[model samples]
Target: MTVDEVVSRSDLSISSAHEENLRAGPQASRLGVLRRSFQREVHLDAGHVLAERGEAIEKANLVIDGFLLHTLHDGPKRAIVGVSLPGDIVGLSAFGIGSMGHSVVTAGPASVRQLEFPLFEELSARMPSIVLQMASLEAAVQRQWIANCQRLTAPQHIAHLFCEWRHRLARSNGMKQVVRTPFSQTDLGDMCGISAIHANRAVANLRNAGLAEIRRGDLYTSDWTELEKCARFDPSYLRAVRT
Candidate 1:
């Protein structure tokens, strides 16, 4: 789908005017001006393919904001990885090896810092932080994959996801911060390894139970305690480590 469609379908609240300023400023990476010689930024729409199936690998993205999904297409089945929230890096392994595997697509309208693979490799030679962060992120992704492989039903998986989200947001200071969440039931369901109907039902159940409020392409937690119980989530997985 096009970026426009993602914008239309999502209830994301981004300032176009400020975004323009950031894009045009000397500090902005997209402009390639001062203070931004190494980093590049890209805005992706929901369902937009960051990299299509079997596409050449050129860059690995660090998610500065929004959500994304990694999917594998095996003839008739499409298996989706869970949501890649902010602070969660994507395409690490593929980029590390200098090749691409599967398709990395946007879960919704997302803002990302796109570091060229060559540049990343070059920087890693000098900056240890990049390598460390990539390693940590890769480990996280591996764990998620293992977890999904032995996962329960979709609803149960989603419950786990919700719990994880809470922990993630809390660790990132995102839970208490005021920012728009850009996820729909369809997208959430896709990440949870469940059907869209089931995903919607799960969200409705959360809302009716007064733990979260899911509406108009927005997902917000109203009662963290209740939400935690619904998902039976533990916060340990969301811990942040210095890289």
Candidate 2:
């Protein structure tokens, strides 16, 4: 649905964690001004390409729902460099840059409000704090990506990935213990830098140890504390980026 449609429905609200930050902070009134400047909204189906590597980004998309996969392509091989959840902006780097280094694709059905690059540039110039916030978010995401590629065991890597998602979802949607993940084993492997077979084995290990289990697109943890221990997860980084 469109942003106009979303705004008209009393039951629906802009549920972006980033937008929530904009609302809760001193710049809350500024958010309304920014929303008024929105050009339109775009809806995407699974596997739809939102932005392509090396292509100029004309607009920045504010994710309203679902997930996006950021991928790096090398010859015929591709790696998932990041995953964008609701409340994240997809092309914020395009503020001054000509093109993006990686491609953004829909991981599932999703919707995003479009803001033209020129308008974003103008708005950001008037509000320097937004730029600072975006930079902090980029840094946080990069740090998490580096941590994911660290020398952790297969299960530890996979478990940590799930734990991160769990925390992210909770922050964005008030999601509790259960996480509704729409990723496949192959997708999970790509995100964790493991093979599909290895990912399967790691997931099984998590389940057998009573840590967590991914069943029918949902991740359930018997004990969140125990699961965090297995993953060596520190949620402080996630908290630090929030307003």
Candidate 3:
């Protein structure tokens, strides 16, 4: 559906986490001002490409639900640079840019609000704090991508990915430890830069170790401490500005 159509729809969903952030902060009034101009929410089916690489990112997106995988292509080689969870803003880097550096595709059935660049600029003009938050978020995402691509081993990457999701989902969903992930083994592989078969093996290993288990389309960790140790996870990359 078109942006205008989605905006007009009364049933359009908003990310509760995002709304809370905007409404609870010191810059609440400024954020609220910008939020009022937010565009309509759009729903995407799994595997749908929300924006393609090399195309100009006319708008930035606020994810309301599900995950978005950012994939970068180098000739025939494809690498997943990042995953956008609910309450995360995708394409912030493309703001004031020429084109998208990577293609964003839905990891599952997803919902997002598309904020056009012009409106984003307006938001920034009204409240620079929001822009700072976006910048901080983008930096955090890039740091994680660097670690996943260059520092972590295959198994460590998978474990770290899950741990990161747990923390993110917790912050967004009443600070819960269990994360509801709808991704398949292939999606896990993409995020971890491993093969689907390898992802399955890694998961099996984790399950055997009593660190994690996937049940009913959700991922639950029996012992987060052990899981973090197994992943060698460091939480510094996911921190946002406290203000």
Candidate 4:
């Protein structure tokens, strides 16, 4: 499906995420100006490959809506290295790197503002805050990978991801303790380093233990404090502000 198809199927709130981004902060004005410079706004359907590993980095993308998977692909094997949420700039690391480090694939319907490499460099020099914010996002992605790979168990990884998504989506939606996920169990498995069957079991265990619950693609946790403990989660990794 195209972007129009996705919007038609959604809550008819296609511009909700875009509006939120364009009005977010004092920096939004400058960002908006920069965005207006770019002519292409891409709407990707699920399973679309936004970027491939080792491909020449020609442009970067700012996600206005939906999610994407950053995968490290080797032969036929692929492991999800990160997830690009709304407000994320996909392929930012490729700015000076010449080639993409990982493959970026759309997980659901998504819209992105594509910025050419020259324009991206210009923006970095002209708008330092934008650069800083992008750096912060890169740090967050690295931290998440560390947390998922080295710090947390499979179940803990699942809970921690849910918590992170809640915080991220809540930043824009203002809905606490509830996150509408477009990711399926297979996607969750890729993100959490497990099989789909294992991910299902982990979700079941969380539900059975009263730690988290999922209904109709929405995740909810009645007790965040307890869930945090269970997941060994730290919100600091999710912070976008410069330290």
Candidate 5:
């Protein structure tokens, strides 16, 4: 999708995630400047690598319409560390760094607005609030991922992942009972640190409990409150900062 297309989409409240932080008061006008500064829009198919681990960072990408999987590689083994959704920045760490610590690839067909490193640096210098907002978001995402892998049980882990995604989608787009996703059972397992078979069973448990179900490529939840309880989810960490 082009920048104009993304801004015009009624489903998206702003052109970029950072823009959301600057939406109110006088900072609102900076949104237009930020949008125009974006270099270009690039589209990728599923499994396409956006950045390789330890590779020099040339630009940062703002996710426009799909998911990006963040993974860590060690020899032959790999672990899914995080997933970047719509309105999320994929390579913000590149701002003051030369290389990405992990590999990032498209989980499905996705589009991103590329901000060249020099331009990103310039923007960051001019608008310190953007850096602050991005840093806050990055920290929250990391803390949530750590909790998901360490504290939650298999079923709870899976449920929490769904709940988090649902909350995030609601923020970027709009709230809905059914969340459209591109992640498969294997992908879900990777995110939750479980095998595909274990992930299947966990999903079954959620379905049996009338909490949630992953059918096809969508997550259907009947009872939001119950599902939140099942996942032990607290949405505060994922809440947008309104000023």
Candidate 6:
């Protein structure tokens, strides 16, 4: 289906939904198997939409390269809800519903390891290990929401988000604290419920405090502690895992 069609279409079949379990987290071996099950590969340029509203998800993606924005749409306007970076999984809602909750579009040039919808359903049912891996991913996404909620304003929300995102990257990469932040001021503004101008001001204030260095579209968090404090951002509030 086309991107424009998603908003108006709703006649998809129920079989599009797949079964899922909470155990999918903290399991490495099962996730590898699940990752390999995907045969189709999607290479998206920046601005390409991965899934649109009401579009039946015949496949979901694992980011092989680049970033994705999970966005909520209202008419021609859009709002970014969450992000998908490397090692992060996207398309979880595709398994629980007939269509996506929002649109998933490439924030940058990206490629995804894509899996067949029916095969994914079968794997989830047959491999108990798959459930564990899925659970792990689901938990991470949950924590993001909790983290954003603690912020008193958009600036704090952005600050908390960066710290949380950095921590997740560290956990996945053997304590390496550096990450190449991909979003722009405008992107952050949308996710944080603020205007682009406000996002830019927040970034400037953060930089003046020696907390981060945003050059071009890349943001470098030199002192995460300071940034967190300046944002009044707290991590204890954002632990997406149910456990």
Task: Specify the highest-lDDT model's number.
Answer: 5
Tens-place lDDT digits, model 6, residues 1-243: 332232122112111221121134444434544555554577889889888878998876777778788888777666887777766656666766768878888887998977656656666665655554455656656566655655356666766667766665554454344556668888888888778999898878767767776666555776767777877755554344322
Tens-digit per-residue lDDT, 37-113, candidate 4 = 44468999988998888998787787788888889866766688887877677777776687888899988798887
lDDT of 1 by residue, 1-243 (tens): 332332332223334533664666522322211112224677787778887766767766777767677777768666676456776556555644555566777766888876566655554454455456546755774586457547545545555565666556563464562224566676666666667898888777766766666666555765556655665555544444432
Q: What total of clashing residue pairs does each candidate reach?
A: 0, 0, 0, 0, 0, 13
The alpha-carbon RMSD values of the candidates against the true structure, listed in the order shown, are 9.5, 4.8, 4.6, 6.8, 5.1, 9.2
Report how far off residue 185 is in candidate 2 (Å): 0.9
lDDT value for model 5: 0.76
TM-score of 3: 0.81
User: By TM-score, who's the top model here?
Assistant: 5
lDDT of each: 0.58, 0.75, 0.73, 0.73, 0.76, 0.65
Error of 4 at 200 (Å): 1.7
Give one digit per residue, the lDDT tens place, for model 5 in 178-217. Answer: 8888888888888887788998998899888888888966
In candidate 1, which residue pairs clash? none
- Residue 123 error for model 3, in Å? 1.5
Candidate 4 regions with alpha-carbon error over 4 angstroms: 1-39, 215-217, 240-243
- For model 1, the local distance difference test gives 0.58
Residues 7-109 of candidate 3: C-alpha lDDT, one tens digit per residue: 3331234455445755687575445444444566898999999889888878778888898888987786667778888777777777667678889998879
> Please, what is the TM-score per model?
0.68, 0.85, 0.81, 0.80, 0.86, 0.76
Which pairs of residues clash in candidate 4, taking residues 3 or more apart in a chain or in different chains?
A: none
Whole-model alpha-carbon lDDT for candidate 2: 0.75
Q: Give lDDT tens digits, candidate 2, residues 100-210.
A: 878999988998988767666666676677666766776786787787677578888878877888877775588588888778888888887778899899889988888
Sorted on lDDT, highest at the top, how do the candidates line up? 5, 2, 4, 3, 6, 1
Worst 10 residues of 4 by lDDT: 2-11
Worst 10 residues of 2 by lDDT: 3-12
